[model samples]
Target: MDSSTHKLYHEHDFDSRQFLENYFSDKPDMVFGDDSLTFLIENFRHVFTVGHINGDILIDLSIGSFVHHLYSACEFFKNIIVLKVNNRCIMELKRWVDDRTGAFYWGHTSTILQEKEENSDQFEDQNAKLRSAIQHIVKYDLEKENMTDPLVLPLADCVLSAWLLDVISKDQDDYIRYFRKFSRLLKPGGHVILIGVLNITYFTVGKDKFQGFPYDEDFVRKALAGEGFIIDYCKVQERTAVSDLIDYKAVIFIAAHKEK
Candidate 1:
């Protein structure tokens, strides 16, 4: 990785909409459906449904403007607080939550969740439930002691993060440090659901490629145990999508609870 040719994570101007289209959209060009969208949604449904990781407030600190992961969650949690490091991602989320014009269509994701549960609910009704459940979408600064500065957020019953630590962390130490920050938001005995990619160097959004920290399952398990979390459920799906957009070899889902 040359310092001259490649841009740092902060240096790239991330476009939330373009990022969604490239990886998450249902179009023919998009190739991450089976690997990312379906994999994440199905795993989340399993955890929230049979895993019994239910709670009142679920705080989300995710990588992008994705709402698909929350479909299953909204059914189990009453209030969902979304925290974002990027303003663009925040705006994109707000656009969908508010049902503004030109908001990205997520009907396909809802349909996937519905099919997984073998339910007959319309996608529109499911989207409405998700929108109503999302109570806040606030900008956060990871460098700050209080990530949601001045807001003084309530301790969450469940903390959910997807594809965030790897993209933001500069090294393995940074990964654990950030994971500790996420754990702090969970109340005692509360659960934390983490979704991350494994053994990848970079993920491209638009024309720019941002760096990623590569780590194995053993490393993540140790990190969670170090933070006083008890592992409950873990699932890893081997990479099935063959695209240059990301080099991740697998996707991992982890459901763990804080040691009371």
Candidate 2:
């Protein structure tokens, strides 16, 4: 397999709609199942509910235009700043934020969060709150020293990313370098939460395959430790969804805070 053929996410024009339909949609046979959705939502709810993790500002650097993971965080953080590597993803997310007619439906995810929280808020209201909490959605450049250059973003009290590092990094050294840049957004002693798929080498969207950097739990532990972060919670779940769209073996979630 020529790794060169596997494009980094930002290097190619992505099919955002196709990507959402294949993975994030609520279809019964979606590549990522309801269990994965629940896993992400429940874990976020628990981490934020623990009291210490909640903060005034949160920086979100997740891959794609997905906002399902933010339902729980909206309640904890006063504001959220989303950074994206491409304008396509930024526009897709803005459609949802502006309540456009053809935006991706995320009501099911809202239902999951409501069920987890034991609350019965209407889906519209839940989504509206999330939209309100989002302070800005800006495009970024990975090669730049300050990803969001010309606009120095305030250091956030917490940084959260899902399935981003691997897709954007070409190798282990790149992974660590990117992680260090990511962590620089966090205030000292602030927390970071990461959601990743283990052993996934590639994923397809609309016939275009993108590369993923494969790694394991131990590597993540060491990566965080080397970055001066102390892990507080970690969980892994065997792949529950049956799909060929991606070859991930499992999913992992980690919560940690900078030791400085």
Candidate 3:
């Protein structure tokens, strides 16, 4: 968790605006579709996004979809708070926000220290290396008083975590603990939206290797049910991109609401 790790994690100058511009220019017709964005706008007021690191390109897609959905659903803008373990991801997200008109808050652990450090070299990509380095450095950055802390944040209308739980731990108990911690942040009747790879054995982002839990639809459903969240919907969708390096067949999108 030294300064070197911090430097590595925050070393990306990803042009999100340019990326989005290219994306929209290519697919202008479907860029702001009516289904997903409409759903997001009609349901959530405030959003808290987690697990968006620079190396993880899926964050761009996930957040982009969420934002587009919100914009199409609501006339005015809403507040957005992004929580990431990697400084580079936060920086890129901040840069993306700078060109747009919306309120955003960002926070992360200042160092690369984690509770467990056994599988440090799991992924072997530069982005994964930096992300893993940041995770190693900021393992304990989430404090009880911080809004980024999964257990203590104010009830949010919607909480989004993309590809987070699998990277946190391989043990199901540990995964459940993490999910429970995140569940505490939602207000009664609020919703949780998550996307993850199912049954993914392993993958590389930058220079770090990632081992995913053997997650299936049943496991996720049971986990959410255990947390008192009623599963409103779940789907398996494909993620297609030019930077399609990961071998995940489908991305699981889940929408669950807390009972009053």
Candidate 4:
């Protein structure tokens, strides 16, 4: 768990396309993934399907640089600001939002979300709306006093982080620091949507290996409680699919709100 062990944030080294393909290529066995896809949809739906989550702004802080996490969020948030650690990942996400060539197909994810919403099977219209809701895609420095740097945006109504802190942080203590930092991005009483990947230390994309933090359900519940948040809903999806692509025990979906 040494902070020095993480070198995945650099450009080109992370392989954004490969990362998406491995986890979200949409072939079941849970999409060549463990319960990752199932947990992703269910967790996101936990927020978006709720009437209280609708707001004017959402801050999505993610490491994988995929838009699928926001498949359910787009309709609820009028403006979305995506925060990224690497320049290449920022570019990769932008290409998809701009409808450029070579972007990974997230239409499959959209369909799943649409079905959850009880909406009609209209992929194109929904995808367009998702792209449009995202108004800003910018660089983020997690270790800084201000994550967005030189532009401290207004505190958002909700912060969406999926498999971010655990993958990026070096150890347990650093993970706690990152959690507090995330709270600063929100107003008091604002909500946080979290996806926790359990009991794994590393993952592979193509031939490249990335670091992950091994954590449990108790660690997550305690972390949020310690951070001044009330656990509103927490669901655990056991990893039932076998995949040589990555190793993880389970995924925990948490929807918590900061105490007023």
Candidate 5:
């Protein structure tokens, strides 16, 4: 992998604080990630409405620095463990979850999700619940034979990953292999929720660009099926805001269950 693609996400170039300010904050023009949060919350509500997703544990596989995507899942499951690729990302998450220093703002994301649901949620209470739902935040290394090796992470009843496979990978083959590795963390008949930026080759973190696997919906479907998952729900959200920060055409959300 090229240095620019891989190194951009390391401590030097990647800033969790800047990440939120650019993407997750309530800024009127935060076009980098608003659509993704909106799309994920909508699909999460629909899936939970028709089906039962509650279980003992749900693992979030390398969610980068984002936290609010799991807000809806917290309603169905009590325990949510988030895994990240580096200590920077993990510490960034803990700052928010543990209410420590240097925590980036998530009120915008929390409020938006709470409003979409039927229940009325106070901003403070909602954030508290979100913090409570996250049980642990650990660092994960995909280069290990098993990403959760040494720790022996419990096989989760559900796993959630967003744009992880695309960004961490060097190529399509590596992406599929990484996807399969993450799938092993799920129990039989477990659900895996995935979000991807379709046809994107790279996206910016600060000023540097990082690689994105250029894959379409069909590639994702075939990859998941090959990994023994059955796609149950799928939604594609087109780019609504025009921004030069990222060059992606659409956002995809898929909920798939492992074959028993």
Candidate 6:
């Protein structure tokens, strides 16, 4: 394993969290009163805030204070499960879920940053290079033998993976495959709520860097289609800057169900 890369990622995540906290503190309504959070609260009965939660599972592949917003919004559902592959992310999530009944899992990946930096060097070829890098990262990280397969979790009425897709894998195909695995983790007819970043670049947590996979409305729609999920309700909300330290455009929140 590339230890330096790993450390860099961890530091980036730390910095990102602080940045987001400050960013969100400036605009509470943009996050809490936003339609995306409203859609999630209204749709998913049982939410999993993948990385961390104040009360529910806030499983988003990226790092942001959004997890805090989830906690505040879903305080009624005190039972939350937060999972993260990154030790740093997991720790942050754990702290947020402190004393709450929640489960944590380790599943970290660094493909996004590698791809971003490599492509950043060549401005003209950045998009194509980033896309290619993403594909490679997804295939190797999520599809490799070392990664978890057939993620079996206790039956839940619904699952929520916020900001997860944009950072978990780079390749669209691999992203779809990972989503398929996520779908299988839920019981038949179960639903999933996904929140993603649109055209975001690198973010930081402390000194570590967490990479985001660029995505658009069409990409997200098509990805869900491939995973046997139909969009029940979808909306494109303005990107509430979670961090002034980094550059990101907007966030796309989606509510979909696994066809019975």
Q: All candidates' lDDT scores?
A: 0.88, 0.88, 0.44, 0.78, 0.77, 0.47
Candidate 6 residue lDDT tens string, 153-247: 34444556666666665567756876776665466766676776677555544455566566678988998887788887776766554444445
| Stretches of model 5 off by over 4 angstroms after superposition | 1-13, 121-124
Residue 149 of model 3 has an lDDT of 39
Candidate 1 regions with alpha-carbon error over 4 angstroms:
1-5, 8-11, 122-124
Q: What 10-residue stretch in candidate 2 is worst by lDDT?
A: 115-124
Better of 4 and 5 by lDDT: 4
Q: How accurate is candidate 2 locally (lDDT)?
A: 0.88
Weakest ten-residue segment in model 3 by summed lDDT:
106-115
lDDT (tens digit, per residue) of candidate 1 on 1-260: 54235544534678899989988998997888997799998898888888998889999998889999998889899999999888788889899999999999898887787787654654558888999999998888888888889988999999999999988887889999989888889889999999999997888877787888889999999999988989999999999988988899999999999889
Q: How far is candidate 6 from the true structure (C-alpha RMSD, Å)?
A: 15.2
Q: On residues 1-260, what C-alpha lDDT tens digit does candidate 4 reach at each position?
A: 34245445433378887777777777553354336565587667776776368788899887777887787788688999888887778888989999999987876776666666554665558778888999999887876799878988888999988888778776788788998998888977888988877887777777666777788999889989998999988888777767665578887888899999
The number of clashing residue pairs in each candidate reads: 0, 0, 23, 0, 0, 33
TM-score of 2: 0.96
TM-score of each: 0.96, 0.96, 0.54, 0.91, 0.91, 0.58
Q: What value does the lDDT take at residue 254 in candidate 1?
A: 96
Better of 1 and 3 by lDDT: 1
Q: Write the per-residue lDDT of candidate 5 for residues 1-260, one digit (tens) a residue.
A: 35453453433346656666766677777875557677777778777667677788999874468877877787788889888876767778878888987688776777677677676644458677778888888776777987666788888999988877777776779888888888888888999989888887776667666666678899899999988899998989887767776677888989899989
- Candidate 5, residue 212: Cα displacement in angstroms equals 1.1
TM-score of 3: 0.54
Q: Of the candidates shown, which would achieve the greatest lDDT relative to the real structure?
A: 2
Better of 1 and 4 by lDDT: 1
Better candidate by TM-score, 4 or 6: 4
Off by more than 4 A, model 4: 1-12, 27-30, 121-124
Residue-level lDDT tens digits of model 2 in 1-260: 45679877978898778888888898876857544688898889889887468889999998999998999889889999999987889999999999998999998888877776544754558888999999999999998999999899999999999999979887779889999999999998999999999988998898788999999999999999999999999989989888787888889999999998
Question: For candidate 3, what is the lDDT?
Answer: 0.44
Q: What ranges in model 3 sit over 4 Å off?
A: 1-77, 100-153, 238-244
